[model samples]
Target: MLHPALLDRLCKTYDGRKILDDISVSLAPGSINALLGPNGAGKTTLIGCLLGLLVPDSGAVRIWGENADKLSPETRCRIGFVPQTMTGLTWFRVQELKDYLSAFRNQPDGAEDRRWADWAALDPKARISTLSGGERQRLAIVLALRFSPDLIILDEPVASLDPMARHDFIALLSETVQRRETTALISSHIISDLERICDRFLVMKKGRLIGDLSAEVFAGEIRRLAIWPDTALGLEVLADLPDGSVWVRGWRPELDARNLPVLAGDMEAYFLALTR
Candidate 1:
């Protein structure tokens, strides 16, 4: 069967600079994939291309075995998205907006997953303008998750939420993914927020994907070796290791060389290896 989402040799450029360079990947069904990169690394551009908001110069983005740019309205509604930031629509009351969204969500032949307002705990009469940043984010999340979309794209979803709210959001996200077998792609700089939930990672650099691997494989490949050299070799002790390993500062030259890789270290270290 064809993949649910595919970006095949996608390329996009703006002005004189390239925004995406030969991007190609297929997102697995029911998988939580994290997309990571530094600023200006073309993450947003790639997402735009996927959503058919921006056309790639060459190649294609396919959703449900059909071209994304020309997806039928019914197919399009099956996808959900939460952008990095939202604005305007501040005049609508919380329940007013939910009612408006619900009208569009329940098409004649569409799947129904309703009552997301309750999932988000948004006050019915609250004005969008009066809601806090976290509350706004919560509302956005509910809108995206309400349909139990076949595929969900979240860009920096937890950046504005508090610690407890972040946890709760992840729990909600996980529950949705598990219950409905949803495919989710989340782009975020908050590694800690994504590390536990993501089953796969996509690392980008200079408008190109540098690493794409399952979370388990990534953990095995990028290891933190704590070294203690008996002799004064300085940094030369790690001169023969692979390229991705980082030189942690716990090394002691005079003491015994304790060269052991820590289990389940921070995902940030792996990201650093890809970017640097």
Candidate 2:
């Protein structure tokens, strides 16, 4: 079966610096995947290449087995994107903007459109320019999701939202994706929030894809061990640690025969270990 999205040996550079280097990954259908990395880790660059907004210097992007750069209107319509920042369209009122966008899809502004707007608690008469950051983000999400696209890509989507709004939005997204079996790709620094919905994790650093693993496997395999600071024995033990194991400064009474401590198996810790 074809993947919902695929990047094959994708690379991009800017101003003599490599922004994405030899990155390749596939997004499975009906799954919510999380992209995790610090600033300048090439997360946005990778998303741009995948969406065909920015051309890659090398490699290819394919969506549903078709070239991303040359997707048909029908194929394009099946993809929804919520960018990190909502810009432009500030001159239009909420309802007018919705009508304008709906016209492009040949869809009438009707009950469904109003339903989404109501869910977002967006006022029809309010101008976009006057909306708060969280409200603008909500508007963007409502627009992206109203069409019920087969695939959704969200970049830092919850960055501007408050705690309650963020929780509600995530819950809504989770329900929608599961009910429709839609594929989703979310990039965010909010690790705990992502952990609640994501089944897979992708880690990047210095424009390179450092780690990719299923949440189950990541929890089972990646581990944090505690070791004493003063002992040459601890240093010796560190040398024989399994590849990818991370050690911390502490002690555990329940060491295995090889002196390996029990696994901490934290998502944030795993991400930090890979990026570090």
Candidate 3:
């Protein structure tokens, strides 16, 4: 209801293969949402459909109550995107690249320091081509966030980053998006990272939207229950609790719930259960 950009019954096919089949979702503004799936689950294709980059076989993707394919130039400029792989930044210095991107904007940008310059901790004077992968990715993120776009679509932006860089990127993203009230639609296979940051979860499996859960539902409705070690429990019990319930048995023998009964505190178990 919060100004949702809707994708209604989207279907796509390439060579008779349904990459996205009847996928539908509503993305709300001013929140961080995760589009999570494994390889070939159509995350990128779905993003393409949402951005109007690919024409779907049927259905519609609307942004701000208008079709995504027909968004005004102003509306287009207000959307920031960071692809899984970067290009173009390699040819210019960091500062030059920043300046180049800024010139295209018709309106004044949001706060410079808060947008990215301060926390990204990159040398603007460094040659982008010579920078390390982490540094390059950081710079790319800075560019994507520099203009304070209304909607941000990041496609596996952190998959190639190092551990420290990943942590830094997550922190930087959290700070900037929350402060600027940006709506982020992030696609990533990293469950741990997504679990830590995203307020809502949208799960796709085999080109279908299998799950949608709000942050409140995640915290209140889902639960992690443990079974006693000595007592025998089977997967049969999990079939009765909930639709997406996951049960682990004989994994850990020391915890209060040694059998790890119907754990749902994290998204990993649930996601694995659903996708498998």
Candidate 4:
């Protein structure tokens, strides 16, 4: 089966520094994937390569089985992207911008765009310059989903949103993806938000793909165990375990395994454990 997106041994370098090391991954159709990494981990660079915005020094990028670099206009229209920053069109009204983008597509659904704008609580008549950061982010999302693309890539999409707005955005995203069976790759620093919707996690560190696990496996396998001095299992014993568990900071001798306290081992914890 063809993947919605695939990167094979992708490598990219800039100014004599590697921005993306040898990386390989494929996005499953209709899957909502969370791309997690710290700053300079090359999440944005990978996205750029996948979208054909940046040429990888080596390897290949394929979208729906077609070479990403040579995607036909029809294939390109099947993809939607919400960038971290929305710039250079601040003078246009929201509706005007929508119309401009719609002009490029073979089919433009103005009603669908308006529906998304309403869901985002955006005023169509409002100028882009007048929108707040969160509002601009909302507009970006609306524009990206307006055409019902098969794949959507979002970068720090909810960075400027409030907690409630973030929740709503996640819900909207989840619904849209499920309804359209659209594949989504979301890169964000907000782990909890991603945990709420993403079924798969792709962890990167220092420009390398360090981990890839389904949410279930991540929660079950990657965990923090509070070991106490009283327990027969010492740090050395844990070190000898077959699973290759490494000891992280904050060792408390007072807590024991009998009353073992297990941290939720959510995405944030797993991300920190992998990166740090």
Candidate 5:
């Protein structure tokens, strides 16, 4: 299991604008965590730090009980990473490429090797150059699974795949996560895909951690609340709610309020008051 603690990243522009300011988060073991953020939110930078591809200006990345920077080659070998960028040239053949990768990592011996190959349905000799984008993605995925790593990090792994391939990939990932007892951190802009397998999601905006919501919490806490402001002063009154869960949709008077569904009125009212 990989217990990750990202302390903070302080990135500053030449103009003195802070790009990433005091970001921090902890990732638990055996959990599927989705990092959701808009562009320029520093998701890529954070991933780079996790993968040891980039050093943070100011931060600590810890894995399990030790610092990530001090991880040994043996520890590093137990991690599988699939970057958003393509790994190799399209000219390479699939089977040939996978075989080359297999030689680098020590896969399980005996029947396990056959089982892993069969699991991905990858023929050892197929030309990667002939595969489609989805096929390439699948091949990359299988390559990542080759060593049975304890932790897998995927960045937009399904973006290039078709709907069916995407579905199959998620299913395969779900099965692997349970069977192998592996933890995963997948970053994707697709909300629906993240909603499917992610136990929790970390929301980021402008390089800041904006929200941390579990799937169940999101389903229960996020709601559409409608309100009609009686006066200009009414907006000010509603701004004092407790939970700070409100966002203004628009400014209008005499809202019909017919479309409003039955909700936890207390929470909705609380949100309205707080974010007002």
Candidate 6:
């Protein structure tokens, strides 16, 4: 059986303000999970805490039943993390930089360069300063995956990549993770891309977990209703929708309605009931 990547009631704060509040979720081995939220929704903070870059005020983080902080260097070797920012590297050629970082993974003598080059899809002879933003981002991913870690955490990894590059990178990442049976936790606002790659999703609002749903649920359950209120009755009907799901859109209404498919219990009238 695959092990569970655990985060048990984790909480983090900065300057007396809570960033993560009792956040708890798990990623199963060989699964891809998407972390999503609006700006300032604590996605970055959560990543920092998970990577041991920031200590939480309370709670524990573990992977495959091993506490992250308690893990020794060797155990820590099984984790890979890539931040949003491209790690600045204007000093070395692409090949030189890959060779340099690959050493830390202890790959066999000549194999390091080969593996890095293959994974990055970049010419080792290319200079870092001359590489485009997409190439640099690819190198960063190569550095993260160089060790063949059991778990990969990426923050907005495709943000800088061009459309084609982003598509290619995602395909490569998906294949690599599945082939290696590696668990991945990806945080990005690109819902469309995530919908394509993620098996599960975590939604945050106001620094707290608001929704936890699988990819299917996200697509099937949540709905955007393009409503036209042509009459007073329609206005009253629109007002009847459940709280939080109701909103006025000029001459129409665009609502996020759930508990769909069934459409039971006075679908149109139920909306009027709420609006009234």
Highest-scoring model, lDDT = 4
Clashing pairs in 6: 237-272, 239-274, 239-275, 240-271, 240-274, 240-275
lDDT of 5: 0.64
Per-residue lDDT for 1-276 in model 2, tens only? Answer: 999899999999999999999999999999999999999999999998888889999999999988888888888888989999899999999889987887767463365455566668988899999999999999998888888888999999999999988998888888878987999999999999989989899989999987787877655444465533336434322112345444442233332455554555568866776666
* Model 6 misplaced regions, further than 4 Å: 1-4, 108-119, 219-276
Q: Candidate 4: misplaced stretches above 4 Å? A: 108-115, 227-261
Question: lDDT (0-100) at residue 72 of candidate 4?
Answer: 95
Task: Select the stronger candidate by TM-score from 2 and 6.
Answer: 2
In terms of TM-score, which candidate is stronger, 3 or 5?
3
- State each model's CA lDDT, in order: 0.78, 0.82, 0.76, 0.83, 0.64, 0.69
Return the TM-score for candidate 4, rounded to 2 decimals.
0.86
Q: Name every residue pair that clashes in candidate 3.
A: none
Q: Where does the lowest 10-residue lDDT sum fall in candidate 5?
A: 233-242
TM-score for candidate 1 = 0.84
Give the C-alpha miss distance for residue 154 in model 6, angstroms.
Answer: 0.3
Query: In candidate 3, residue 123 scores what lDDT?
Result: 81
Winner of 1 and 2 under TM-score: 2
Cα lDDT of model 1 by residue, 148-186, tens digit = 788999988888888887887887787778877889999
**Candidate 4 structure quality by residue, lDDT tens digits, 78-124:** 99999998888999999899889889985646666656777788888
Question: Residue 188 lDDT in model 6?
Answer: 78
User: 162-199, model 6: which lDDT tens digit per residue?
Assistant: 88877867887788778878899998756677767788
Error of 6 at 45 (Å): 1.0
What is the lDDT for 250 in model 6?
25
